[model samples]
Target: MNATQFKQALTHVNLLDIRTPREWDDFNLGGFHVSLDTLLERIDEISKEKNWVIICYNGTQSLIAMRLLKAKGFTHIDHLEGGLEAYLSL
Candidate 1:
């Protein structure tokens, strides 16, 4: 979703930050950190009961990650429309 929609619904969804460790250490907007590279291996760590919002540097990676999660049977997966860059700008 776009930043406005994301912010409006943030409180109700599960957030997954899929940025690299270095990127995560640079700054975080809360939620769990699981780099996209290792996401598949750690898929079980995520909860299926809640909607998930994936996050990344520029939204490109997170969009890919969202597709992966959907293919893995996650029904409610979405990525930040423009990732942190856009979100921060908002």
Candidate 2:
């Protein structure tokens, strides 16, 4: 998403980095950092009121994250279309 769109969406949604911790340290995203593997374990700690946007290096991991969240019954999970590439390009 573009910077403007991201900012606008932030009012309703939260960004989530689903990559591994190594990946997170290599390039951190500006929101909640939850590794895909750990997210399921921490589902109860997530806020249902806030929408979630999954992000990763190239969008693949985000898609996986989205599917996983959905399986857990997360109602407002979204993913960056092109992951960080799209955000940085904007």
Candidate 3:
């Protein structure tokens, strides 16, 4: 999605940033914060119904994170289509 679409989605969904700790310290915006490693371990603990929007430095890792969440039966999962770095560019 483009920036406008992403912003609209985040208005209704929980936006997540699943980057490395170091990467996040450099820059992060949004509430849901889970490193990729941690998310892998706690995927099942997240609420299945809450709208979850996974993000990473780029979109690649978020896709992986999204897949992991989906494997846990999270039906309301979403992702920042272009991730945070892309958001910054916008």
Candidate 4:
């Protein structure tokens, strides 16, 4: 999803930020913070009930994380189209 859509869905979907901890500490939209590298190992911490919106620096890692979650049986998954940079551009 685009930044606009992401804002609209904020209350309805859970946000999964896959950026590095340093990136998150520098700036964040607030939700769950999980680095892409450790995502699979920490999958147990994520809930499958709520909708999810994955985000990364430029959408690459988020797209990858989205695919991984889907393969793990997560059905409602979405990702920032161009990532935080795009969102910031808005």
Candidate 5:
């Protein structure tokens, strides 16, 4: 989803941030954080029931995370098209 769509759906979807720990600490939109590097290692911890919206510094990593989650049988998944950078820009 794009930033606008994400904002519209914010209250309904689960936010899954997949950035580095440092990046998350520096600034974040507030969500369940799981760095991209450790995503696979901690995949099992994420719930499949919720509608998840994956986010990263840019759209790149979140796209990867969405794929990983889909592979793990997560049916409801979306990602910010341009990430927080784009959202903040708005």
Candidate 6:
């Protein structure tokens, strides 16, 4: 979804920040960080029952992550369009 739509859905979604540690320390948007590189290995750390919104620096990584999750049988996954950059712009 777009930034505005993501923001509106924030309260009802579980955010997964898939940015590197350095990027996360630079600017955090209140979600748990699992870095894209380690996401697959750490997938169990996230709850499968909740709606998850994957987030990345510019949204590309998040989209990739979303697809990965889907392939792994996750049905309630989405990516924040434009990522944190778009959210900060608002």
Count of backbone clashes, every candidate in sequence = 0, 0, 0, 0, 0, 0
- Give the clashing residue pairs of candidate 3, or none: none
The candidate that achieves the highest lDDT relative to the unseen native structure: 4
lDDT per residue for candidate 1 within 1-90, as digits (tens), equals 999888888898888999999999999988989999999999999987778999998999999999998998999889999998988898
Residue runs of model 4 more than 4 Å from their true location after superposition? none
In candidate 3, what are the lDDT values of residues 13-71, reduced to their tens digit?
Answer: 78778898888888877667788889867665677878877888778898888887787
lDDT agreement of model 1 with the native:
0.92
Tell me the tens digit of each residue's lDDT in model 2 across 1-90: 444576568657677888889988888746888888888898787777778888887788888888888887788778877777777776
- lDDT per residue for candidate 6 within 1-90, as digits (tens), equals 999999899888888999999998998878678999998999899878889999998999999999999998899889998989999899
How well does candidate 6 match the true structure in TM-score terms?
0.94
Cα-based lDDT for every prediction = 0.92, 0.78, 0.78, 0.92, 0.91, 0.91
Candidate 1 C-alpha error for residue 69, in Å = 0.5
Give the Å error, residue 52, model 5: 0.5
Per-candidate TM-score against the hidden true structure: 0.95, 0.79, 0.84, 0.94, 0.95, 0.94
lDDT of 6: 0.91
Report the error of model 6 at residue 85, Å. 1.0
Worst 10 residues of 2 by lDDT: 1-10
Task: Pull out the clashing pairs in model 5.
Answer: none
**Model 2, 4: alpha-carbon shift in Å?**
7.6
